[model samples]
Target: MTLAATIAPQLPYLRRYARALAGNQGGGDAYVVAMLEALVEDPRLFDGDCDSRIATYRAFSRVWNAMTTAYDAARDLEAPHHRLDKITPLPRQAFLLTAVEGFSPDQAAQVLECAPAAFSKLVETAGREIGAQVPADALIIEDEPLIAMDLEHLVAGLGHKVVGNPRTRSEAVDMAHALRPGLVLADMHLADGSSGLDAVNDILKSFDIPVVFITAHPELLLTGQRPEPTFLIAKPFDEDMVRAVISQALFFRTGEPAPAA
Candidate 1:
């Protein structure tokens, strides 16, 4: 297959990772653009030496670590956002790559171009430092009381306070605006047949914060839409996955520490 074809299917997710690394869509996409340019100049960057996904991330990491001044100029011109200022870069990257992005330790090590042993240390340090962050006040938006309760329990267990659990699109937006939660966990569909997407967008219009969407029909939202959420989960989601995404989202925003080891 052609290089573009090989990378195209994974591009959306790669963009997500880049956004997380850079702290915002604009800056994140800047790095992704640079990675693409580098790959275009030298197609060998995606050589079949590794799986296409791995090769793609490895190529992006090369661009990220290089941190060329031109890319900085581009991002500065785009408008700057403070991110990763408090967390150690390698540790945060390692943690996000492995924990939130679901890459195996070995795979993440390969992408980061670090020895497996060293990569382990990076992941460990990241977990400890991130877990050390102060807890955030979180908001839960779901139609199902059982699921909402479960989410509330999970949030509280993470040491974050649950500010509200709103079941409808209107309630979700209202609670979000009123309470001003540091993090939001929302279901895709609400009780009134309204969209969590709509609610989150409305809330975002009033304030900037991290959001996690839980959906039964993720394919509906995966259409390469702009303002896409970086954190998402499928119905009957894994608890570990939910916790990790929430932690990662909060980590970038509040510089919240990661959970205990």
Candidate 2:
């Protein structure tokens, strides 16, 4: 079968898997698209002699693993209190199979490489864990007016508040000192060319606030070897992904061990 023909039937399943892995819908969809793009770009990865069903399953697994690894590497550079620490491996896999993909217990178990009973137990554990990790508030610091406004709307929609919108590093520092917000969303290059790192450092100097750096220059954040609780959301963003990051940050900040929503 052609590439599209082979992959089309699995789109729904892929989306479900993404949501389970991402703990939200938008991030899940992005992962599915990213996986498809990867498949298109590198056909040889799926050219194995195994059965087509098994090969296709493996392809999806590879993409999920790549995305998870990339996310983990990016997350580790953040401060421990700022990163979302709820997503464990087993539930993440079970969520992909059962929730997003609509797989039966037996089928989902097959995909996750585990027995049906084991998979069910994993799902229950993940559900309880995710419930425990949801956050109650958010912090925002964007220099651009329009982008900041959009972010505000997104945060509010997630039932969170925008504690403040500090345009400069000093403003952000002062706000963090004042509010002690549960979560902070900042732009990397601020109006003063000072960068969000300055704001983050200042906040860290005083209070333990988790931060999500939204920027056009993700490469800058990627290169640094920082600790956890600091995450990077590249510009031209997906609203859902931003929400997921914010939720994760808030959970990390509060020391609540819940998965992403």
Candidate 3:
């Protein structure tokens, strides 16, 4: 396959990881653009040895770590609005690569250009950062009693209050209005045939809530078609994975109004 064809399928995921690393979409995408420019200027920077996905992320890490003029300007402009200023950048990237991006330790280590042992340390440090974050009231929008209960337990376990667990779209919206949760964990399909996407959209219309979407088919939403959730948990999720994404969503959330339509 041509280089573009090889890299095309990875862009959406790269965008997701970039956003997580930068704490916002605009900053994250800026880094992605820089990475692309760097690759265009010096194609040798793309490691031919690694798989395209790993190589792509490795390229991004170079851009992120370089602290180019673009990076500094963007960071200065976004510092007032982001919460990532407190966390060390390397640990955050390691955590996002492995925990949120589904990279194995070896692959993530490749992306960060770190030894496996060092990668483990970075992930541990990131976990500590997650534990130290300020807690907030969380809402769960799920239809399954078992799943809802599990989510409530998980949210509460993280020191966040379980404000409400709504099982339907209308109920989700109503409860969100009443509780005004700081975080929302939502399922993609509701018991009443309502879409979790629609419910989140309706709530976003009223509040700039940070959301972590949970779904069996995450690829359905991950398509690079429109604005998508920055944090996502696939179904049959590992508890640690859910915790990581929840922390990320809460960590970067600024409660600013949703972008203008």
Candidate 4:
């Protein structure tokens, strides 16, 4: 396959990482576009040893680090600063690469040009930093008792109080209206044959809050056809992924200090 073809499928996923890391879609896509341009200028630099997807990310990391260093020189390329960036540089990247993108420690370390042990520390430190932040009230909208309970546990573990777990669209809307949660986790399908999307839309009208959709239909939602969730967790998620997205969503939504990259 041609280099572009090989990189094409991974581009969307890479863009997702960029959006998360940069803290906004536009800024992230700008960096992503620049990385693609850089890669086109010299495709040979794409590391052949690692997985192609990982190699592309490694290259993007280099570009991002460079752009960050010379941000003032390229003012148009600067990304929005958020509190999450304050946790330090490599950890957030490492955390997202592994937790959000499902890259192994070895691969994520390669992306950051760091050692595996160092990468592990980066992920751990970021977790602690995020966990230490002030918790907020949360809601869960899932038809399955198990999933709703699981989300409730996760939300509580993060020091947030769970306002309620609703099983249907009406329940979700009703709970959201009454409770006004700061965070919400919704499922794409509910028990009562109602769309989770509609439920979220109704709740959004009532109040603006950070929402994470844990769905089995990730491809349908992430196809770029609809407004994407700021933070998304696919079905069969790990705790680390949940933790990372939750931290990111809350961090980006609030008026907190996001350190210079």
Task: Tell me, by TM-score, which candidate is best.
Answer: 4
lDDT string, candidate 4, 1-261, tens digits: 787887888999999988777766777898889988998898876887778888889888988888865232223323324445555667778767866787866777888888867775676667556656646778888888987888777766666778788989999998887777788898999998998889998988866777899998887678887788877778888665676677667655754322121
In order, the Cα lDDT scores of the candidates are: 0.75, 0.63, 0.77, 0.75
Better of 1 and 2 by lDDT: 1
Q: Please give the range of 10 consecutive residues that has the lowest summed lDDT in model 2.
A: 74-83
- Native-referenced Cα lDDT, model 4: 0.75
lDDT of 4 at 197: 84
Candidate 1: stretches off by over 4 Å:
1-94, 99-101, 104-132, 254-261
> Over 4 Å off in model 4, which ranges?
1-48, 52-90, 96-106, 109-125, 219-225, 254-261
Write candidate 2's Cα lDDT for 66-94 as tens digits. Answer: 66453442233334321223556666565
Please list the residue runs of candidate 3 whose C-alpha ends up more than 4 Å from where it truly belongs after superposition: 1-96, 99-106, 109-128, 223-225, 256-261
Where is the poorest 10-residue window by lDDT in model 3?
72-81
- lDDT of candidate 1 over 172-210, digit per residue (tens): 877776777778898888899999999988988877788
Q: Positional deviation of 137 in candidate 3, in angstroms?
A: 1.2
lDDT per residue (tens digit) for residues 84-109 in model 3: 44557787787778766888767888
Best by lDDT: 3
Q: Candidate 1, overall lDDT?
A: 0.75
Q: Estimate the TM-score of every prediction.
A: 0.54, 0.50, 0.57, 0.61
Instruction: Output the lDDT of residue 175, model 3.
Output: 84
Clashing pairs in 1: 130-257, 130-258, 131-257, 131-258, 131-259, 132-257, 132-258, 133-256, 133-257
Error of 4 at 101 (Å): 8.7
